[model samples]
Target chain A: EADIYQTPRYLVIGTGKKITLECSQTMGHDKMYWYQQDPGMELHLIHYSYGVNSTEKGDLSSESTVSRIRTEHFPLTLESARPSHTSQYLCASSSSDRNTEAFFGQGTRLTVV
Target chain B: AQSVSQHNHHVILSEAASLELGCNYSYGGTVNLFWYVQYPGQHLQLLLKYFSGDPLVKGIKGFEAEFIKSKFSFNLRKPSVQWSDTAEYFCAVDIMNRDDKIIFGKGTRLHILP
Candidate 1:
């Protein structure tokens, strides 16, 4: 099994509430990513980080912001949650090697009320 | 404008039947290909990958993928599939020197009936 972990495997929050989803990895990877997915749908990359202190927005635009304070931790935060934000959040980490493949965590299923 | 395409949106098959899922990418460069599977209520996991060497690569659970560089396609195949193989399969492409981001195709949901 992969060493990545995501907190609050399931969460239900009211609209306008601020929340943060935590992601951490024990593999010491240099690249981490956050992807949003809905039931029976494709995954959309929302944010990614190269390493500590470097974060970049992904192809899909998202209201959530991410920070990379340490190599092992990359957290995503939403200023105010909304019903439209209900989706599954997946965290993944990968090394910089040419043949490296990403390892995903058990996703966090968010429900906005 | 790099993107991946999965021809089949959903497929239904009987146990012990042959399986082949088509995947095509638009990028024309050195790419690392991957097939990821997500069972119901489970996280996405790597089923197989093709980085280099022999065009055919084998992965866990009897899953295999063939990389056709000329066609820009990496298709997943299985000679005999079991009910446990029912899951959503995603085809991903990571273009070399493109920040190492993996672009995923819309998944194909396979339902294998016992």
Candidate 2:
């Protein structure tokens, strides 16, 4: 089984609230990523970290930011959540090897009302 | 910019029917391709992947995909599909050494008739 985990499987919060989606992986992977996906839609890359203390914005622009303080933890924070931010957030991790597959978390579904 | 494309938005098939899903990428150089499946209310999981060697890669649940480099396509196929196979399938591409991001297609929702 994949060791990645995300907190708050489901969340309903008021708009403008600052929220942080937690993601942690016990696989000791060097490549970690966060993707945003809507119901029945495609997954859009939002943030990724190559290694500890190295984070980069993904192809899709996102208002949220992520920090990789430790290899096992990567958290995404939304300064002020909006209705547009209501979507499922998925976390994934993979080894640095080019041939390896990524392991994914269960995902956190957020609802901003 | 590189992109992944899934030609079929949704597909409906009966049990024991042959299935095929088309996927194409717009990268010319070496790439690592993957197929991921997400069953209803479940997390995404790796169905299969192709990094090198044989182009025909078999995955879990009796699914397989062939990587045709000349056509820039990696199409997924299954001889006989079951109801448990109902899920959303995503095709992902990683452009080797050019970028660290893994781009995914819009995904095709597969529905199997019981």
Candidate 3:
């Protein structure tokens, strides 16, 4: 089974509420990524981390921020949520080796009211 | 910039029907191709991948993909699909020696009718 896990399988919050989406992996992978997707749409890369204290923005611009203080944890935070931020957030992790496939989490479906 | 394209947005088929989904990528150098499947309410899982050698790669669940480097395409195919195969399929490309991020296509939703 894949070791990656994401919390809050579904969330519904009012606009302007602060929220944090948690993602953890026990695989000890050094590379992790976060992607956002609307229903029936393509997934867009939002953020990624190479390792502890290493974070980079992805192709898609997002208002969320992520931190990688621990090897097993990479959490995304939204200071103030909006309806526009409502989407499914997927977390994945892969080995540093080239051509390795990534393992994904169950994903969190966020709905900002 | 590297990008992946999936030709079909939605496909409906009956049981025991042959399946083929088109995927194309825009990359000149060496690349690693991948196909991922996502069932309803499930996370994405690797369907198949092609790195080197054998142009034809077989994956789990009786699915396969052919890599045509000259055409810059890697299309997924299944001889006979079942109702359980209904899911969303995504084509992805990883440009070798570039970056670690894998580019994903828009995805194709496949619905199999019993």
Candidate 1, position A32, lDDT: 96
Measured against the true two-chain complex, the DockQ scores of the candidates, in the order shown, are 0.81, 0.92, 0.81
lDDT of 2 by residue, A1-113 (tens): 99999998999999999999999999999999999999999999999999999999998899999999999999999999999999999999999987888889999999999
Interface RMSD for each predicted structure: 0.6, 0.5, 0.7
> Residue by residue across A2-83, what tens digits does model 1's lDDT show?
9999998999999999999999999999999999999888889899888999998988999999999999999999999999
Pairs with steric clashes in candidate 3: none
Count of backbone clashes, every candidate in sequence: 0, 0, 0
Which runs in model 2 stand beyond 4 Å of their true positions? none
lDDT by residue (tens digit), candidate 2, B29-80: 9999999999999999999999999999999999999999999999999999
How would you class the docking of model 1? high
- lDDT for model 1 comes to 0.94
List candidate 1 segments past 4 Å from native: none
- Per residue, candidate 1 scores C-alpha lDDT tens digits across B68-91 of 999999999999999999999999
